[model samples]
Target chain A: MDMAFDALSDASDEALLVLYGNGDPAAARSLTLRMGPLAFRVAMRMLGDRAEAEDLAQEAMLRLWKIAPEWRQGEAKVSTWLYRVVTNLATDRLRRRRGVGLDDAPEVADGAASAVERMIDADRAAALQLALDQLPARQRQAVILRHLEGLANPEIAAAMEIGVEAVESLTARGKRALAALLEGRREELGYGHD
Target chain B: MVMTDEKAKGLALDDFFAAARSDLPEPSGVFLARVLEDAEAVQAGFAAVPTAPPRAGLFARFADLVGGWPALGGMVTATLAGAWIGFVGVDRIDTISGAYFASAETLGTVNLLPDGDLLALAAE
Candidate 1:
């Protein structure tokens, strides 16, 4: 009965996933609600477009639902698996772009290329997102997972299918690039003194 | 002086990262609905691995009513035994019990009873 599924807010994601595999619909609803935002946020960070981000999030969640039945307990965390899925999907989308790649894409933030054209200065987050979008796919993935998602280096490594040193290297490079891109916007973005 | 400048640069970037974190894009209601729909669709195709068998049918219910197969077996054995007892004549049974007890006057066997009242007591 649906009524029997109450008090399930505290259940871990893996526990809920196992329940979903066992044909419990409540578990599905709860899991989707919990993990959907994470997928969307990461996808948005990796890919600047909202439409594509939503699609990737939905696709990642679909994969999660499909893998429910065979989800091995204590083998891996649900969030980590989800991070891997989102990053891989975003990477595929990045690769499929027409005439766009690490070397080919513009290095500067869109519209913030020169001192004459400052970032709109209304939204710091938007300014940061624009800078992040200019980064390579791997660096973006590492930065989003490490800084935005607050994941550890090892966990980011596991998610990105890379070594811990690679994760560190990507984040360091990503931060340096971000700093350079946003350096011209210090006064306009409201961080004049800092 | 250069280290100080680098520290300020790091601090500025940290502020931007914090803004991005706080300004996370919310998943639209439509997006949530679509995902839930997808989740339901995916779950629907799953082969339900029931740990136990399906619901009980009439015969199974009856078996349960009779306290399961062992109880039913015992009841059948008892019914057959009663039928057999009814089919046998009393005289034949008396012969067997009387021979065993040595209480039959015609058997000429040694009398083994204080009183010839075993079957009567058993019946009582």
Candidate 2:
């Protein structure tokens, strides 16, 4: 077990993708384990709904598996490609479901919690989520990729398929928009009091 | 005053986003397991299909040439010679056509007067 873990840990993303392309079942699992969190987080950040984010992440991973055989080497990192796919999927979902309220979507709890605590956390999360939901899709993606994911401008550009200057502009605009949306509710949302 | 106000607001917003990050939900282990299972099923589906193997290499093609290196070289040389001969033959045809035209002009100049007397009398 330790040996297998070590082997997986040592393998490059490209090598793992090649293995997956060659129809190795374990490689798919390993890839999902490695990329799932990032994909889910990006999707959630972009879509602001846990259920939708989960769906988008799974769909992106499924597409990744289906496309492994056609993946060309040195084009982009597997993780970057996955990010682009999830981002585009989430964007499409948002466009399709435009003008829908978050209240209508089912809420997901982090884990088992007391009724009161769950409500409090959910409300706070929901409020922040609303603010994120209000951002333009491109700005939201840019913010998630740059600030949350900590990608460099060039990397974000590559993932977003834009120029570096465009990335900088998008991130700056996204930050301004997010700040404006969250500013009024800061005290209500329990931020910056300390 | 504006710069200071903007800076403070920016810092406050950053702090707020930091707190928001903590409350973001995580995917449950069950969900993770299901995703992995789905991935496995996909891999299995792909495995059910067979793919063709890669084609032979350039070296293999070269080795398969029936005649040896000398024969191949001779074949290439013969092809080039045939092409050159065809090109030169076109030029030769053009030259023959030009000569034929010149001979036709010379024939047109031929005056076969039975005797120069009738032609001189007609001229007079």
Candidate 3:
């Protein structure tokens, strides 16, 4: 089983998916290790709750495992599909927990910082999150993929299941909104001239 | 022209992004492990459930036979079934209506004239 996991670790995402489809347990573990952190991080940023992020990540991985049998080769990157699932799940959670803002979310376990640094980081994260929250769900997802995840426009388009032009429009509008929201507070967020 | 303006906006946005990226704290190792463990548990749950092999039942097999012959076999079968049921229903209704109409006609108490003629006569 260890050797199987090692082999699966070396396999491409598509190969792992095929193995997963064959009900290989090691392949499932390898795929989870490969995608778990990414899904968790994206969920954390999108949902702003570590516990919920963990739940969403687990749910997304379970969904991927369940759908492995139906996966087609050369359709889309497994990571992109996972991101889309995590994004949609986080969006659903956000909608369900309406009127609950990120500030109200419990802080991460190791989130302690010096007073000054805490203030700065908190202000920045809060401003950025607020701007993100104001965006339409799809636009927020587009911005997160394009800007935060550093995905290319084409990849974002694929992850979003949208046209390239639509991705471009979403990111453009999202960035504009973010900039407008964060403009005057750049210095307070420690983003001013060095 | 607009090129310079776009470049300046890009630069400003990049700086803002760099700061934002730097401010994001790394997730704790414990948190990361917990996430992985949760994912593994979920995968295990799915693994525990054995998936049944795909098989067609008796009714489905019959459907396949009647549905497979030609391009329109399935459609023809469906259409014929629908038409047959409809014919049977209409036949029943016609029989009932005919019996009632005959009874009324024989009694000479029923006039089958058009409503327009009745209305014209009433007006007169």
Candidate 4:
């Protein structure tokens, strides 16, 4: 079973899509394992709400499922396609919630850390998320994709449907804005002792 | 104490990002299950869509019904020819059959009594 899962994960996304189109549960499981967390994390970082993020993730996966049968081979990587979908969905929510502001930052965990340390870390993360919320939607998306999600600039460009130069500009300006937003709050968030 | 240098600020921002990365939340079980459920639902929908079987043309069915292309053509030709014979050829053949089988005058009727040689038949 381990080997089967390993093999499934190793299969190309297109191959998995074909399997999924044929109603293979293993394919669906593999796809969820491979892309689900990424989608959720992206949505969470973009929207800063777990429930909304989960919804967006499920929506994106549902779209993927819908397109599986008509999914052309070698057209787009599954990750890229899913990232674009999540980004669009998150951007829509962001537009809808514009001026309504972000909800409270979610509780994040730091394994093997002392309780006090974990609290500080969570605060820092929350502070970052709040600051991310302040940026323009595109800038926030580009920044998160580049820094937190670790997608390369080109991949980020594809995900955002923008040029590499534009992605660079967005990330640069976003980082500067974040730095400005987060400058004085570092000590309050418990980062100075680090 | 707030360290106020560009480089120091950059380091602090990097630290925040590191913390964010480290503390990022994974999808819960319920969320994963929801995604898989959606997948199953969509796939089931796709399965439910009825696909029409490939249609065989009349000639193709006929070909299969007979034996091969040549035989199929031959069978069609034979049927048409038989129909033509029944409709047109039968009338001409009927005239020939009537002429060939027409009754001729009987050669001659044989006399049952011999002339003058017949004795007076006594009534019995």
DockQ for each numbered candidate: 0.45, 0.23, 0.13, 0.50
Ranking by TM-score: 4, 1, 2, 3
Question: lDDT for every model?
Answer: 0.84, 0.74, 0.71, 0.81
Using all chains and alpha carbons, the TM-scores for the candidates as numbered come to 0.70, 0.67, 0.60, 0.73
What proportion of the true contacts does each candidate reproduce?
0.83, 0.40, 0.22, 0.84
Question: What stretches of model 1 exceed 4 Å from their correct place?
Answer: A1-6, A101-122, B47-124
Candidate 2 lDDT by residue in tens digits, B1-124: 8787577668765654555566656876766777788778877877788778787687656745747667777877999977976887855645665697765434334566657778788999
Tens-place lDDT per residue, model 4, A74-182, is 8778888988999999999888877664354332344312444445666778778888987889999998988888889999999999999999999999998889887
A95-171: candidate 1 lDDT, tens digit per residue = 78746654664433444434433443336788888788888789989999999899999999999888999999999
Winner by lDDT? 1
- Per-residue alpha-carbon lDDT of candidate 3 for residues B1-124, written as tens digits (9 for 90 to 100): 5675455556666665555566563555665566556545655665677779788887667667766446357677789977876777755655566697764333223457878999999999
Stretches of candidate 4 exceeding 4 Å from the true structure: A1-6, A101-120, A190-194, B1-4, B55-59, B63-124
Docking level for model 4: medium
Which regions of candidate 3 are displaced past 4 Å? A1-5, A97-127, A191-194, B1-10, B19-124
User: Runs in model 2 with CA error above 4 Å?
Assistant: A101-127, A190-194, B20-24, B53-124
lDDT of 2 at B98: 62
TM-score of chain B of 1: 0.42
> What lDDT does model 1 reach?
0.84
* Native-to-model Cα distance after best TM-score fit, residue A49 in candidate 2, in Å: 1.3
